[model samples]
Target chain A: MHLLPKKKKKPSREPYREISPGSKPVKWIYLSIMLWFMGRAIQAAARVDKTVKAEFDALPEGFAFSLGVFPDGPYMVLGKNIHGQVKSLGRRGQEQALDVRITIKNIEAAILLFTFQESTAISTSRDRLIVDGDLSQACAVIRILDIVEVYLLPKIIARLAVKRYPTWPMTQKMIGRIRIYFRAVLGY
Target chain B: MDTKEINIIQHRQPGIVESLPYNYEFYNPVKICSGKKAMAHIPFELAAINAVRPLVLASDSPIGRRAIKLLTNAFKESEMSFYVCDDVPDNADAETVRRLTTLYLEKNHDAIIVAGDGAAVDIAKVIRLMVAEKTDDLEQFEGEIKLSHAPAPLITLQTFDGSGLEASGWATVCNQTFFSAQLAPQICIIDPRMIIPMDIKTTWARAMVSLTQAVEVYMAADRNPVAINYASTAIQSIRKNLAPVFSNWVSNKKRLALINAYTAAACAFSNNQPGPGFLLGKAMAQMGNLNLGTAMGIILPYVMTQYMRKTNCDLADLLRPLSSDDDYAGTTSSLRGKKAIRCLYDLQWTWHQAGRRKIPLTLKDAAVGRYLFPDIIETALKNGLPVFDETDCETVLEHAWEAKPLNVTS
Candidate 1:
């Protein structure tokens, strides 16, 4: 009397694709999904850096960033010398630089490097890491590399020989450049 | 065809997610991602100069290999060193993909560029997902736009078009199972030269699918007006460009426009949420084991006519834009719908005039018969797609069986 009646039988789940005795469509599909996940993971691993994360977390209120980081060398980003000053603001803001300064330019450049660490553009090779893109995108990636080089790491014996940029602008300017570079790499 | 404004989030929700839908604010930075030979040549040299070593993932075929060679040669004189993974399998397993990622990391590649058709590009996308999300089995991420870590600079270049994977985050590895946005290739590179080399049958099939995609996006219950505008423009472009291809498949410019049309349609359809036409095609394709593109081809014209009959007023607004030859400034709903049907009919005629290149007029040509009708209906129902009922299914299929253009009362 205590034994419960047999539970109702469950309906079988239909296979998404019909699987024949030897059909491998399921296996193939699973394999495909797996490959997709792997590709994304690799891309993420290649971009994350300790300096880039720290720079992001340390942003001041109302301060934001964009950056594109490569797998190796000095992180770098982009900055334009308007008038004689380098501007930190990107496509959204309008605080255009009225006068140019080398220090400001380097700050802009450093910001670019930090931003790149969060970008989607970092890739790996057999013996070399490659960040692919046009001049503007490459500039953004370089800027992120610079941040990791000067701000995060104390001293560096090795460097990815990007464009030689002066480092004298404000720290915010550097962070701004990296933020833009991140946007470029992430294709935001 | 009788459309009540649909909420796209609700349609694909039960199968995909729990939170109904997250607010999806979508924007296309550039309407199209155009890649010149110069661009292909530049990324590596620039990357190398900065010592950024990105992963280069290409289809394991001669054409893809040539693309890789083109870049290496261009960058060789500029002192850039690139490592190419043209060795990825056509049907790469999960283990193989993980190995590729590990190799990429060990070798210090910066990012990835996937070059080829749907399979090859999808493979590269999957590889990116694995590295970003830390997963080997991709099924766990199905039906969600789930992404944790950021992907590398991933660009997909189409070697052949019409798969619709270029614009949509979802990729169909096979019939029923799919991979979601986690595998969305960040950037897409479209080059006309890539499509020109494909066989005629494949081109026609892909174009037919593109047409179906545009119509579905336009008619989706969740039809975003913006997506609709894009869809309409895309349809017009495709109808105009594809008409001449049956006769002359060698026109690169026209081919470019047609490919562009496909991209536009794909972007519009997926972003807006797929409608009845796409659902119907998917169901039939999975059940009958037919080519999805060809199935769409056979059914699309019929669906358009029926949709016009059901939602005559909305149909009119849509057709008004296509009637470039008519005084469409203030046409009535009936008139606009008729004009649109007439325009579609004209496209069919053009295809006939070109070479009678069209989807088969009857199921007999598709190698199935009236006997298969019940199976089609059953499969559609089982898939849980939103349809009025069996009668609605029969009505549309009958129209497809007849393959006659609607008599537009213009």
Candidate 2:
């Protein structure tokens, strides 16, 4: 039975799957949502948390700093207003000449921080944040962020998110929590 | 110390304050002669330092021989007279220092050229001190004695890149280490030709020594911004250049980078007190008959992990220089410090894989037994930084003895 050996079939080439470039619009939408949330969080913190306001007030006028993931990630600048409020300058580039810029190493780190899955101390320890410019100013910024977290988050979450949680009076804590939640919802 | 205690300690933010209440003084006065054929400029450096006659101190090893040959060749055409003493032993005891000092005075050598590894450089340092202080009694110079007058003009030509003795204010004699600003060399020449001929293991070990010192400086309680800058830059250079130098020994550029790293690290270390890791590693090396670098290489990561476990301080800042932007970005902050330690482990593994004589990753890998833990712990407790008590020393030593791959789960 000297049948001719079946000729080996050449494998069919699969088409190269190209990623849709439509991801740009999706990313922009996600970034916009993040920025909106961040802005509202800052405004609420400033309205409710005296410590956060104090830290912001201590900053020099026109002092701005950006927080975001590198490259294509969303960025938001929090600058000291002339009136001593910390306001988000919206999504901007390096044109602001920020005094102290803090960049989370990646989007994952940003998510971890924003979701209160990790504290600033833990993130800094983990090497997830890159601070450029004056370290003292960066420290002040970190203090502000920590205070804001206390106002926005529950005591349990805030305790974990900050290096040390200040012992606030019961009435003040209750009032701060209420104001922060209301302002956050109203986008004040 | 427990994690809570460490956190509390770290909570006192020194970096944030306008001026830290703590005061520290830093001084380094070493003229560096680096780049291609840096040794060729030695005569000129000697002249600049106002020295007509120079004495070369080296070991009897191949490096010492080559150093002698090179220096002899460099001065062949010039009228500059130099004497060679290649008999300096590996263990630079008081006897060797005294003898070298006698030789220095007898020959009327106006300057010294320490041209070997740590031991040779250290011996030369002691010799110069002896000549300057006019005392062979090492007791007078023990601990941190301030020398009234500067030592004779010393030009250190380091054959190996690790010891930082080339620019360090400290020198080890026998079992004791002495420190003085006068011990720092006046001129340090790092030529690639001197380093290229050495075996890869020796080269790597020396580089590891420099790295260990730099990391310790970074972790020290006395850490200042200037020291941090130097240590960070040194670490970055080592991380970038070490593997390349290991693979391609012929590359002068890579060698120069490593040399620069050594110098920077030495400068930083000189300004700060030795940390627990350095103290423990030195003791362990003495106990185990291991190279200081070998002990340090095995112990550093474990020490760092211990530091992280105790303190709330962010060790992740170290990763900024050692890692690429992409890797740094991708890593979460909470994991960054751990990632830095892991990176060091991975680097050690890479070096072991590449080298003919593999570097040990664990104490067991180096034939260092757990039985020696009690001795190591005791020695470490005695020599370790005051911040770490006996318990911390034991914990760190035990972890180092195990030498297993670090996991986040503890």
Candidate 3:
């Protein structure tokens, strides 16, 4: 009687698969463009922006950080303070014990900030940025970014990007813009 | 820029101004039982939540012992059954949580009763989480992992009034913080008699923590109308009862007011995350081994000053509750905010004098040197307040280090 009733075989659990095959390539293309622009922005700031240099110099020696999107990040910038240079470590930055790490919530949020649709404060207040490590250091980094924005973006766009824009002499502004563009294009 | 343009710009900025069109969500499901003998309602509260057998947790401290005696005496005359575990140590870690969870499951307890201060409450929450999740590994639930099922019904009876864990959804198990709406106590009982043995210094510090929370709720960027109303009431209650409670002139009325303030502040704080002041104070406390309440009291004004600078929100509204009617009425709208800030500075000075300098007014006074500033900032950043950077932390800490009255004037 016991041998007459045999248990039915259970179905094996299936691994999760993406339902939409078309979305993968679109996401990669979007990420690539975002990373390219981010690299260009960092290069321009490091080369010509005095404020960025000063901020990096003020940081403790051997301080490093990563700025990226979460989960599927290209990790836009992995920078370290090397004699105040703020040089990029490229993809290798993730392995370091970074002093600060600022992760945007998603690709959409990143695009909004990078494209000047939303300001840093707006994005932060909206709870889009997830910051890790030293808060004070992160603040210093933000200030430096604001300064760089003034140089890279036009006055109208810069006004939208920052809370309060510092007044710079016309000659200094013109010189800073020219140098930023030249270095950004030539990769100096 | 013209005055009009400047005003426009200020209004448009997101965190700087409390602008409309902001999105936020808030939910709190705590039933509070208060009064002279609120602990008497425990049996009824337990029954409401359908909990027959509750595993009671109490610390070994005098207050904790007293709480257990009171609770046991009350339960002896009732039909409900409770098992008391009075050996809960201070700063209970993961191992303690596991042992307690095992005990709960083995005993077949249907509810958890945390009958002491913040630490006991925190331990019970974690134990409940472990039991509900049916796992000893608490790490899986850290940092905002939503629980699929409701936690075992928790009834918290406060022995003292400092920690806002009574109504908060967040709990720090070991060094890692965990959050779940279900973790908030199903019923919280606050009675003044429970805190009678606690010293004046501790009472004052705890009250100050509540005051700081209420103030931060009002100043927070994500604040809603519901939270603001609760915060305003909390501020008023704290202003009325703080000094009286500290002086040991134990009026049940004043004590009750203070308890209500703590509850209101907890409700508001539960709706929002801790602000810069809470984060900085927590960090400083951890680094210096100082009481969180004391650290918060010292750091409150400085953090408020930073918030005022960022938001440019009118602080005059605070004066009505914090100061006299004359002070609120006589002062012009423009000067009222400054007056309110000045009043907070004066309050700190007054408390410092009343305590006969027993309370350290400055970080330097507390023997916390500048060397720990970097560590403190890092701790604060990790805790919360992502909007603040290292520069803001430095500025706030440097100002707090000196512990001078806030420079209300520009």
Residue B378's lDDT in candidate 1? 78
lDDT of 1 by residue, B1-410 (tens): 22332335323221123222344444443224443342333443335334456566766455565566554533332334556666666676666666777776677666666656666666666666667776666666554456778655566665544366566566644232444544565556566545534444455667778788877765665556566666777788876776566544357777777767777776666565555566677677766777777677777766666665555434554464455535454555346656666666666556645645444544456765666667888777766545336766677776676664444321
Q: B191-238 in candidate 2: lDDT tens per residue?
A: 777774345666676777788888877677767777777888889888
Q: Cα miss at B271, model 2 (Å)?
A: 1.0
List the lowest-lDDT window of 10 residues for candidate 1 chain A. A99-108
Using TM-score as the measure, name the better of candidate 1 and candidate 2: 2
Q: Which stretches of candidate 1 lie over 4 Å from their true place?
A: A1-188, B1-24, B29-31, B35-38, B41-51, B74-80, B89-108, B174-176, B179-182, B308-313, B325-327, B356-359, B404-410
Residue pairs of candidate 3 with colliding backbone atoms: A135-B389, A135-B390, A136-B389, A136-B390, A137-B390, A139-B389
Chain B TM, per prediction = 0.80, 0.88, 0.89
| Candidate 3: segments with Cα more than 4 A from true spot | A1-188, B1-24, B324-326, B405-410
Candidate 2 lDDT score relative to the true structure: 0.72
* Number of the top DockQ candidate: 1
lDDT of each: 0.51, 0.72, 0.73
Model 2: lDDT of residue B189: 79
TM-score sort, best first: 3, 2, 1
Error of 1 at A114 (Å): 35
**Candidate 3 lDDT:** 0.73
